[model samples]
Target: MLLPLLVALLPLSAHAAERQVVLIAHPQVTNAALTRDTTRAIFAMRQRSWPDGQAVRVFVLPNNHPVHARFAKERLTVYPHQLQLAWDRMVFSGTGQAPSQVGSQIEMLERVATTPGALGYLEREYLDDRVQVITME
Candidate 1:
């Protein structure tokens, strides 16, 4: 019974390990790393500037996107619905704005790469030289 259970779980574990989500930023952004709290604040749109005082332009996938959900839960330690609620509240209250939403991961990569001081997240498989991976400290 134990052996069968282990075998049954192996593929799920392997698939989980394979889908690594990472924070990515434009190369022009000076910061190389950020604390998870700061990252969360940025994604939440509560924090608007990088530590160096450069204006931060945040990009994101739609709330229903799988990568967006995973990144919100795994990296930011928040649920996608919670993030959406926060954004909606901000918009309705007129106190802040939501991040720009891209239709796909490829668009995310393109926007982050081309926009100065842009920050976003992507799966490991989608990474390339166009954007720099920001280490989450």
Candidate 2:
């Protein structure tokens, strides 16, 4: 009976691990970590530059994408729809521009790695050495 229970729980643990999301940046970025507030500001397009004065290039997957939704909710503490609404408001009011949208996680990884001062999130399985992970405080 205990063996059966352990076997059933194994998949649950693996699924949870697979859902983990991490913030990533271009390898040239000097900062190794960022505060959650600052990150939220950047993603919202309220912050335009890094602390070192480099222009920030924000990237994101579609609002409906599972990884996008998970990152917004778990990392940023905001719903994906809320982000979309904020972006729409800023765009309409001529106050800000929305982040560039990538079509898939593969594109997200490639864009962040190639673009200077780039910032985005990806699931752990998609991560590699081309980009650096920025830990959130």
Candidate 3:
């Protein structure tokens, strides 16, 4: 009975582990905030600069990463597979460049914190002093 109960609760525990994602930018990025559409554009590699005209550098985790999937769906309103295909098309067609890919959340946070004009998403717990949280408007 105990084993059966535990199995039933597994999905709940996994869901509980998921946290809201925050759009974090390097301290040097001039923009203080971004709209949902603009944020989507930035992640989609469609927008290359901050609203203030400063160059925007983007970072992302691997397509299969949980945080990447959540952010792609919840915040960007796009699926991870779609984003991957879009990126591949852009790279292949010479229309755009892909966002820099990091191996893990820790690496993502570290790169975004140190690189100027950088932007990436992180679960709330991964946030730190080195990066600024860009509020979604």
Q: What total of clashing residue pairs does each candidate reach?
A: 0, 0, 0
TM-scores of the candidates in the order shown: 0.87, 0.92, 0.85
Pairs of colliding residues, candidate 2: none
- lDDT of candidate 1 at residue 94, scale 0 to 100: 100
TM-score winner = 2
| Highest lDDT scorer | 2
Candidate ranking (TM-score, best to worst): 2, 1, 3
> How are the candidates ranked when ordered by lDDT, highest leading?
2, 1, 3
Q: Give the per-residue Cα lDDT of candidate 2 at 123.
A: 95
Per-candidate alpha-carbon RMSD to the true structure: 2.7, 1.4, 4.4
The sequence of per-residue lDDT tens digits that candidate 1 reaches over residues 1-137 is 89999999999988776678889999989999999999999999999999999999999999899999999998899999999999999999999999999999999999999999999998877889999999999
- Poorly placed runs, candidate 2 (over 4 Å): 1-4
**What lDDT score is found at residue 48 in candidate 2?**
88
Winner of 1 and 3 under TM-score: 1
Candidate 2 per-residue lDDT over residues 27-47, each given as its tens digit:
999989999999999999999
Q: Which stretches of candidate 1 lie above 4 Å from their native place?
A: 1-18
Candidate 3 local Cα displacement, residue 74, angstroms? 0.5
